[model samples]
Target: MSFTVYNFTNNDDVKILHQMGQFQVLQWDRDLSLAPWTAQQAWFASQMDVRRRQLIANLDGRTGVTLQAGAMQWTAGQIQATTGVKGAGDLLGKMVRGAVSQDSMIKPEYTGVGMLVCEPTWQHLLLVDVAQWGGSIVLNDGLFLACDSTLQHALERRSNLSSAVAGNEGLFNLRLNGQGTLVLESPCPQTEVLYIDLQNDEVKIDGNYALAWTAGLQFSVERSGKSLIGSAMGGEGLVNVYRGTGRIMMAPMQAATSYNTLASQPTS
Candidate 1:
C-alpha cells in the first residue's frame, strides 16, 4: 500500500554539505513561504535574505538515528521506531530528569533502512563529533537536535548551589557521553561562534553566552574579581566561570537577544 507524491523531480536545490559515517547533512536553498504573502512579510524576507532556509539530514541503511521529539518531517523505506528506553528503571530516571531539566521524557529511536528528514528551520544546524569533544559534552538547555544512536545521555548538576542561582541557568544540564555525531540547533552559524581552548586555565563570561563545553571542565558562578567588593567596584556581579582543561563554544551575541529579534519578526 504505497503511492508516489511526485512523478518527476530534480534535487538541484538540495545540496549535501557534509557527510560523517552514516549521516549526511543537506542544505536546502529555496524561497519558502514562511509567512503569508504580505507587504510586511515581503519586506522582512527582502531585508533578511536567509539563504539556508532548511537543513535535511539523511541517514543510511541499518543505522539508527535519534532526534528531538517532533523534529522529524518524513521518513521512507523500512524504518522502525522505539521508545529508546531500556527498562522501567531507566524510564523513571529519564522521567525525573526530564521533569527537572525541561527536556523530552521519551526520545524516539529509528532504525533500519530509511531516510529521516527534519523540518525546515532557520536555525543553523551544527554537527558535533563527541569524540573531539573529549568523549563527553554538556549542552545548555534546548540546544539538542539529533544525534547518532551510539550516544548516551545523562544529567549533570552544578557543583555549587550559587552557580545555579546566580548564573541564571538551570541547576541540571543535559550531558551527552559516548562516541558519535551530535546535531545541534545553533543560535548562529558556526562562523559566528568563538572557540576557546584552555589548559589548566580559566575564563569568566559575563552572561550565559557559552553554548556547550567539555564535560571535564568545572563550571561555577563566582565574582568577576578576586573579592566581592572588588567585583562590585569592577562593575560586574555574578559571572559564569569555567576552570580546568576543556573547550568552550561561545556566541558573540546572546541567545536570548537572537530569540527576541526573531520574535519581533512577522510570522504566518
Candidate 2:
C-alpha cells in the first residue's frame, strides 16, 4: 500500500493509472474562466483550514470529530459529536482514528497556541509536548500531568526552572519548563471553560474548576462566607478565586458521562 500527495496547481500533467494496485494523485487546478482556482482546487483549498480550526466533538447532529491517541480504534458506540456548531467532527457510523491523533508529533513553535479540547466525559489520553507548548488543562474537580521522560528527569532533579517557583499558582498549573510531553485526564469536562484576562484584575470560580492560565497570574483559593449570607442561598457555591492579570480556563457544571450520553443522540 502507498500514498501520493499532489497540490492542485495543475502544473503537473495528468497521469493515468495503468496498474491495478497503484495509487496516484490527479490534481486539477487551472480554471478556463473561474475566479482563480478550478472548482475542485478551490474546494480543496477551502478544506485546508481544517488543520488550523480543529475543534472538540460536537454532540449534536452527525459529525466528523477527530480523536486523540489511544482512542484511535473505537467503534461508533464509543464516540459522538461535541459542538453546537453543526457539521463539525461528530463520530458517526464507523469510527476511524485521526485528529492529528494523540501521541502525534509536535513542532516547537506552537507554544501558548495549542489547546486540548475534549468532551466532559471522555476518558482517553491526550499527547502533548510539556516543554514547548506544555498542557493547558481545565477541570472542575481534578487534573494531573503525565510528563514525558525528558520532563520527568528535570522534575525529579528539582533542577526545573518553573518547578522551583515555590507554592504559588504557577506550581498548581504544573508548567513543564523542561522538555517532554504530558498525558492528562480530567474529571468533570462538560463545564464551561472561560479564559478571562483582566486589566491587572482578578476573577473567581466555584469548586476546583480552574484550569491552566498564564504563569504571571497569582493563584489561591478563598471562601465566600455566610456573613455575606444574602446570596449564600443563591446556589452560588464557593468560588475558586484568582487575582492578578492573565487567563483562566473553567469547565462546565455537568459531568462528562452525562454530557457524553446527550452527545451520542441525534437532535430532534
Please provide, for model 2 over 144-177, each residue's C-alpha lDDT reduced to its tens digit, 9 standing for 90 to 100.
3233223321111112324224212222223334
CA shift of 129, model 2, Å:
4.3
Cα RMSDs of all predictions? 3.2, 17.2
Model 1 global lDDT (CA atoms, 0 to 1): 0.75
User: What TM-scores do the predictions have?
Assistant: 0.85, 0.35
- On lDDT, the leading prediction is 1
Q: Candidate 2: minimum summed lDDT over ten consecutive residues — where?
A: 16-25
Count backbone clashes in candidate 1: 0
Question: Each model's C-alpha lDDT?
Answer: 0.75, 0.33
Candidate 1 local lDDT, 99-135, one digit each (tens): 8775788888888775667776666677899999989
Candidate 2 whole-model C-alpha lDDT, 0 to 1 = 0.33
